[model samples]
Target: TRATDSPSPDVSPDPSPSEDGDNSEGAVPEGYLGSWSGSIDNASGHSTRELVIRQGEVGEAVLTLTAEGPLATGGTYRCVFEASLTAEPAEGEAVRIGPSTVTEGEPMASCTPGSPTTLTLLPDGSLSRENTSSGEKLTYTKSG
Candidate 1:
């Protein structure tokens, strides 16, 4: 991932904490708490995504993501997903969350309600979200 001191000009960082409480098992690390935004221009079309992660149950984190992009046929498509993620063991400064399950975001057949994703906290403080199934990657900076 690219290391930069700041996010993109159009990307606003929202560093606000999602909750105020002691860290618990499987809770997202303090560094990974908050909102992140990023975009990509691939063959599918230009798409922008925003992800919000919050502490969840004893062994899970709540991830809410919204993505919008142009459809191949025409027009734009928007999808929202709420997933339950579990922390995976990692080395060094990287934190990995995986085995994501889409608890919601139904009624949209295009949305993958059962696809697992990899969420990594890079050393530079940016978040890397990867779709394990499609191999789509998006680097996001903390929202401001």
Candidate 2:
């Protein structure tokens, strides 16, 4: 598949709280409730990525990532993954995603097949993600 031909992931906005004040089970952290999009260019190629964070059914942060770009073998591909937020310490409560699970496409050799990932939310409402294993770093801005 080509990068432009890749299907856009379903990115719904955060659900509104119920009328009866019953948001206990689905209360997502304020800082992590939005859609972010960005692209990274490197020697291999450029990739367009989107990240969506929303409240989970059990009052946890659910993060979904969709990335599409060219492959080393001369074609394009898309991959999607989902993860739940876990505890971590950072300058303003970084939102970490993991024990992540790939939800689409074959696992790329560069990214950790089954490891946790962290996303640092800057004070200016931007996001920074770094994959130490693959030495991949990307900066994303909040999407309107």
Candidate 3:
């Protein structure tokens, strides 16, 4: 049988559901909430950032980044970022806004987020994300 396409690809007047019943409740997966740590380095120096994600019922995730410096004048710094994520096509997914990653590295990420950050957990307990604007690839390794 031939499949028909919907007129509007976005914000369709009629919405459909998925198999996982992800839409049962508009919220993020419980697994997304937790702490992720990674090492970040640059020409300036090396540093680390730990993210503590707190999610709400609506799949909204609040992240806190405790970072050190890669610059000569750099020192230990902490940045707090709040973003509301929504799995529009499904559920438990979200989009966020933030700085773009300046560079890439091992252990952790060196740069930042371009737009809102989209973070997903990997089976190995690592969090991988691509900076929205710059598309700088970053993967945060687990500390424990």
Candidate 4:
């Protein structure tokens, strides 16, 4: 979740893959699929995030974050957000998703339910997850 102050990112449904070829309008480009994980350990606290993406009506994705320590208000918190990939991204462009839904683990009066995120595939194959709302970012690697 994120703060409500930041501007919202555009949200749109991903298009179905065209039968003609693999380069469909909404097809998730290679390297954007599968599961990825990242973590943050700093003065604020420690958080671990996981993202799982798979083909669906649109490119489907679920993001989960589990955190503890001061950042989490000294308590553990887990949040899950789901959304479809907005569109087919060009090579090297970030893949954006959300205006997400909080399916679970929202603490009382905490955790914004609808925040957008952008995922950039890094040179080392790590996925960088950035909150469009708060500018918070994390780096994730492919997970088994």
lDDT of each: 0.69, 0.69, 0.56, 0.67
Write model 1 residue lDDT over 53-129, tens digit each, in one string.
87665356578788778777676777787766555444443444455444444336556654667777888989998
Better candidate by TM-score, 1 or 3: 1
The residue ranges of model 2 lying beyond 4 angstroms of the native Cα positions read: 1-27, 57-61, 88-91, 106-114, 132-136
* lDDT of each residue in 64-130, candidate 4, tens digit only: 4433224445656667767767766667688778677666664634544667788888888888888
In candidate 1, stretches whose alpha carbon ends up further than 4 angstroms from where it belongs are 1-26, 58-61, 88-107, 133-135
What is the full ranking by lDDT, best candidate first? 1, 2, 4, 3
Clash-forming residue pairs, model 4: none
Candidate 2 lDDT, 1-144, residue by residue in tens: 569876666554555566333744443456767899999786669988898888654324488888888778777777887877665435466566656666787446544444666677777878887664565667889994
Total clashes, candidate 3?
15
lDDT of 4: 0.67
Candidate 3 error regions (>4 Å): 1-26, 57-61, 74-76, 86-114
Cα error, candidate 4, residue 89 (Å)? 1.7
Residue 65 accuracy (lDDT) in model 1: 84
TM-scores of all candidate predictions against the true structure = 0.65, 0.65, 0.55, 0.65
Tell me the alpha-carbon RMSD of every candidate. 16.6, 18.2, 10.6, 15.7
Q: Whole-model lDDT for model 1 versus the true structure?
A: 0.69
Clashes of each: 5, 0, 15, 0
Q: Candidate 3's residue-wise lDDT over 1-144, tens digit each? A: 755674657666665666345654534456655777777677777766676666544444455556655445554443444444544323534334344333333223333433656776677867876666566756787553
